[model samples]
Target: MKKHGVISFGEAFIDYISKDRSNTKFTQLLGGATVNVIAGTRRLGIPSYYLCRLGVDESSLFVEKELAREKVKTEYCVRTPSKKICRVYVYLNEQGERTFHSYINPTPDEWLLESELQRDLFENAKIFYFGSGTLFHETARGTTDRALKYAKESGLLRAFDTNIRLKRWESDEQCRETILSILQEVDLVKMAEEELLFVTETSSLEAGLEKLSGLKIPFLLVTRGSKGTYAIRSGSGIFVPAVKVNAIDTTGAGDAFMAAILFGFHEKGIPENLSQLEKYTQFANEIAALSTTEIGALTALTNLQEKVQIFKWF
Candidate 1:
């Protein structure tokens, strides 16, 4: 079989988002950095697969159903009674920025083990994507490492999104250390401006880029919300301004951006030049901006197919 689509491995949980700044009502939505990427890619008409262990809880059931509804293949997902899907209370401010207020995690250690990963999934995927959400735990980290090794051996393009949630990690230092360790292994990396600063322990984006330059990441993206995204290749960078929109919830914008880039890579190939990289980043910024026009991350992606058609790159 020909290698196709994207395979993502990480946490998939429920985001209980506040309806307003008043915090009176909440809405349940399917979310998680990696989940959003997989669903986002599938929404953009790419074949997508999710690899993780899910519990038999209500939230886990919701995640499974939502993934199925999105046409994301979940045949590789493991189901066990010991796993408990994490629930995050997302509080949005007046500006529609979200903060992970609290977590309801009954089984943090329960994760798909390294041995559970099926190598054929990596072999058949065009790109393998993941995030930092599950790396805080030892078992998941091991599994992620194993999956990365499989992806590399299979010659699949590997992508990492440093969707850092400080509250989930034991400490900022640990988060920075864990992420930096994995940088050299991935072909592409996407991070927010603040995450770039945090991971590099630098005060400015230039300094952070300088630090990451040492790792020689093939493609680097720094997303500055409302401002634009910076796409860096071979020490050179270009800023792609975001498409203006009436933002509702800024959540999953980065994932949407990642999905677009990965979608481009899946359809085309790794951008071989700066101009090609800019085109991909420009399209990604449009997708990211559009995702915030609705409340939920996945909810905003319903019209992504149209965007893909408009931004068709052949």
Candidate 2:
């Protein structure tokens, strides 16, 4: 049995989503790559922990309650005085696509300091997951780098998500620079088609793959939404199509996919079986496609039926 758990660090906040642009009524849901991944992992029966600091504010309190409800371990989560949780308003179009609008400035989640991290948490994990959100600000970058370095020293597999948010960064160049920096520390790298293009500054998939060839990550996945997920390992690329599902909202689908892949790793370590990788990839794609059948991120897989559906893919 795998004796280790997974630790993920990044943004944790509330997402206020609405279908109408009028913004009169909104449904609030916990939104963050970190939270979504852990939530999805736990639903898939993987031992997962979340590591992020929150304030004593109402939003933070809500997150606390939700984490408890989801049974996500929070031993490394920080709650400090006078801090506020980050919140974003997401608008969903008719096609289930999303657009983010930040109502508030100074997103507290971006100010995570190096002093706030718990290095001891790295000792008990098999994987450490971090993302582009952690690299946006100076303080959070310092903290993310420290935690990643500690995870590296402790021999934990590092998972990197290049899920790009254009609004978070000042320029495309800065985004590329930070992503390249994080790439050096990651063993497993995940991105969508657009992310691959922007990060590699390439117009085509082959060109993007060529750019990433030097990074030599053990597993590199590029998700192409409806088309499917593409995986590259040992210089070989495999394309797996997504499971057909009626999607209502596209939020958190990528996180769900990534979490399922991590669940595979935690269950049996990295794929030694070429066929096993395909199985896991298809399973993840199913989970992701099913995730869009609901309005909120966590709600898609929060119920027992949804959880059961996750295993049915395989």
Candidate 3:
């Protein structure tokens, strides 16, 4: 039997996130929602690839090294002639909520034109993953849109993490339109409770899930933070409570959650045949909880066997 793998499409950049109460020091880590998911999935022993562009700077080189170390293929990542790598500075509130300060680079997403895209890489992938921020700019928007169209038409399983960073978008209306348009092409969507409320303009999770389900999405995962998480398929809903953990920084928890779920499903085989969304959600929530036990997003995911051992003790 042939093995299954996922190909993630989106941006790869550095996150200059602060971890102190006095705001004394900031740390730079290789991060992007899509890349983080790929990394997290890899940590769970899943084979995946990150397809994106980065500057030919030291930071970009570090990202390449890290992805390679994680055993994730990077044949589709492009190195640009740009000045430096893109970075997002993160600020954490008292409640561990995250805020971003971004340095928008000039690397054009047109760099991902069909000439550069690894057709063989994508053609061999079982899943194609991306998020909304990649659709914010015209250059990236055009490239990702085309890639998504191709993925949908190619009969690949499409996953969308509706990672709506309001600051990156032109307007709420524009964000809705672009995201809604892309959702139609996606086979799965993972969204947070707040994002669901914001995107659907619904005050309740049930109503919000119903609205998203009406779009004909096959699998929908909704994370409700401390309250737990939910997954629905063809109107069948499954809920899993969040793992208890003292969160130091909540920045990458969602990415960890997304990756764990994908990893779980990938490990299990068929997404449509698996009625174990609840089990995956429970496992993913534990991964996300463990992620917040430390600062960096990818911290706890590194030692999966150890982490699973710890979870067993929990």
- Sorting all predicted structures by lDDT, with the top scorer first, yields 1, 2, 3
Q: What is the C-alpha lDDT profile of model 1 across 1-314, one tens digit per residue?
A: 78988999998888888888877689888878898889889989999999989988787889989889999999998999889888889787878777768889888888999999998888888999999976899999999999999999999999999988888888988998999999988999999999999999899989999888999999999999999989998778998898999998786788889999999888878888988899999989988898898877767778666678777744
How does candidate 1 fare on TM-score?
0.94
Local distance difference test, per candidate?
0.88, 0.81, 0.77
Show model 1 residue runs off by greater than 4 Å: 19-25, 91-100
What is the clash tally of candidate 3? 0
* Model 1 Cα shift for residue 154 (angstroms): 0.4
Structure candidate 1, residue pairs in collision: none
RMSD of 1: 2.1
Model 3 TM-score is 0.88
lDDT of 2 by residue, 154-255 (tens): 888899889898887989999999998788778888899999999899999999999988988778889999999888876688899988888887878999
Clashes of 1: 0
Off by over 4 Å in 3: 1-3, 18-25, 91-102, 106-111, 272-275, 306-314
Pairs that clash in candidate 3: none
Name the lDDT of candidate 1.
Answer: 0.88
* Cα lDDT for residue 183, candidate 1: 92
List model 3 lDDT by residue over 205-235, tens digit each: 8888778777887788888888888888767
Better of 1 and 3 by lDDT: 1
